[model samples]
Target: MTQPSQGVRRSYGVKAAPYGFLLPAAALFVLFFALPIGYAVWLSFHRIEVKGLGLGKGSRSEVWAGLENYTSALTDSELAHSALRILGYGAIVVPVMLGLALFFALLLDSERVRARSFARLAIFLPYAVPGVIAALLWGFLYLPDVSPFHYLLDALGLPQPDLMDGGPLYFSMANIAVWGGTGFNMIVIYTALRSLPNEVYEAAKLDGCSQLQIALRIKIPMVAPSLVLTFFFSIIATLQVFNEPTTLRPLTNGIPTTWSPLMKVYNDAFTGGNIYAASATAVVLALATFVLSFALLRLSNRRTTQGATR
Candidate 1:
């Protein structure tokens, strides 16, 4: 047989190289993400049945639950309450966090801003901290005895309100998320701002537009994609809030084990020992996330297309 031509070998190598490079990533994705999700989905439709007073291996068996778990999760008042709490939390978090992120990004991009580098680093520093650690740190700051705000109120002879109770608890939790997240979102928006053509700003200036006017008109519109991206992540993160409230739980009675949907899933799986129910709730939350994310993206795309057409 004739040896393969150099061109044939080269073409084969070119075709094979991309797959070779992707192999590791594909394997890891399957092993870690895809397999786990598939397993959870399988577990969601199963329940463990106990027999003979649950005493031996033969006493326990896995049985098909069909949509029983889903039905239970859907009808669960605790789950519904948790869902509402998260929605309320997201209402406070997504807007306030993204607004501050946008403001800081625009401020850092402004020509008159001082200590720009230091300010950016300071804002983004909290992003470096782990979510659990950030929650713990903020939890301490909310404590009446240790909190500086409480100390200030004492000094001024005013009533010091509990930060971890009632209406204040929502803001307390929101504040932790905002503080930890705003910096990262700001960096994303700031990077997008920096990518815009300077000519746009110059043209606006030549047209007698002030800095604020240029920001409101040109800068914001230019970075709308980044804003949408940040908003999407913020909404997801707000919905999945667990660490902040969980950490604060020990400090106050306001936070329950099922304070958020994700937390409710956790409680069902571990604390309540109902893995099937937990899996079903997790699947529901995941589906809701996908639906909301797709809807938002579609809306954003429609708006973008309409804007471009005009």
Candidate 2:
């Protein structure tokens, strides 16, 4: 028989093999995620201390600023306006995108719908297009001289509104997001719909249920998991609205450097040369994202449990 010491050694080896394999991933998480996060948090609490013409040895120092950065960030009216602008943008993008996705998914799932393959491909084509290119294409389309919309409006003697200006810019940008995102979300929902057992639908039909009744009762309920997942991701994406606006910046005068929160952070860091404040804003944004995500997950879990019990 093996000695107890040898047996213990062998057991330890067996248990440790998995951890040894996981070591690389753990190291990467520490180096890339944990380390940078810790650094950012440390920086957020401090600012540059400049002395005497801001040049010489010991001239630049990082002094503790406590909650000064947070206070300033909170009180900045520009940031407040950006937040409200994003809120309005999100209000439009989230519902309209998800609604169109859900509608397209349902239509695709229905047996009577024709040319689904072609329609699906056409809709999903935008996902392959780069965000910059997509924005540029739409940017030109929104312009008076270049747009077919302008020609049609002029022919009809109707007023042609600039899509990239003022209040309409929200809708314009939201449209880009919806067009690019809907097909992907639709596919996710449609896959869930397809996975449902046929017997459930057959039973509903036998009970004198109409198509709409069957979908509302069975299909939508069954696909709630996918819907929740989509909604969560959509929320995150909406909150990080940067690329579309940035791309459109060169083509239009309306989008300021501080159009979105992320954009604001970028401008502060690069243009304003204020890395300390940028770090603070970035940390705040990350915290907000985590809180929102946690809240969404909890709400989804509660709803799921209540639904399951019923």
Candidate 3:
């Protein structure tokens, strides 16, 4: 048989080029993400059965557990409490973080703002700090004996409040999240704002709109997609909160071993030596995240469609 012509070979090469470039990424995704998730799902459906004295190889065997692990995880009271705590934490972190992000983004985009680069850096600097280090730093600051706030309060003869426990603890945790997250979200919103056409702003200004009016009526609506993106990520991060609380746990008793769902998963797997249950709980949490994220996207799309129609 005659070999294919060079023109046909070139066409084939061009057609295959994109997939060739994407091959490494696709391989990495399958190897790292897909396989691990598949294994976790498999593990979630199986359990170790201990037999006789549970001392020999034959004494323990893997057996089908069906939905037993999922049921136990769902009915777990500790998990319920942890979920409630996350809801409250999300309530605080999401709005405050996104609000500050949008506010900073708007400020940075403003023409009258001075030292914009320095101001942007100052706002985003906290995000550069590692979460564990930030948590530890703030944890020490929450201590009355070592904190400057405590010293100021002492000099003023004022009562010092314990920030590491009770109601203050929520704010304590939320503050860390807000500090770390706001900057990243702000950059995203700022980039979105910068992409907006200057003609719209010029027209609005020609119509006698003030800066505040332009931002409120024009900039915000134009940047709704960025806001929604930030909101989605904030929700995901709040749901998966582990580092800050876990780091600060040594400083206070307010945070439990199962403070968040991810924390609970860690404690169950390594600490409790029950990987099966942990896998089930993790799967459940992943499902919940997917559901909530999907719902938010749907709601956002619907609103965007409505706005476009009008």
- Report the C-alpha lDDT of model 1 over 1-310, residue by residue, as the tens digit: 3366877888899999999999999999999999999999999999999997999778989999999999999999999999999988899999999999999999999999999999999999999999989988888888998999889999999998888999899999999999999999999999999999999999999999999999999999999999999999998888788898888899999888899998899999999898899999999999999999999999999999998999
Top lDDT model:
3
Question: How much lDDT does each candidate structure score?
Answer: 0.94, 0.90, 0.95
Candidate 3 lDDT, 1-310, residue by residue in tens: 3356877889999999999999999999999999999999999999999999999879999999999999999999989999999999999999999999999999999999999999999999999999999999999999888999999999999999999998889999999999999999999999999999999999999999999999999999999999999999999999999999899999888889999999999999999999999999999999999999999999999999999999
Q: What TM-scores do the predictions have?
A: 0.97, 0.91, 0.97
Q: What CA RMSD would candidate 3 show?
A: 1.3
Q: Per-residue CA lDDT of candidate 2, range 86-127, in tens?
A: 999999989998898888888888989999999888877887
Rank by lDDT (best first):
3, 1, 2
Clashes of each: 0, 0, 0
Count backbone clashes in candidate 2.
0
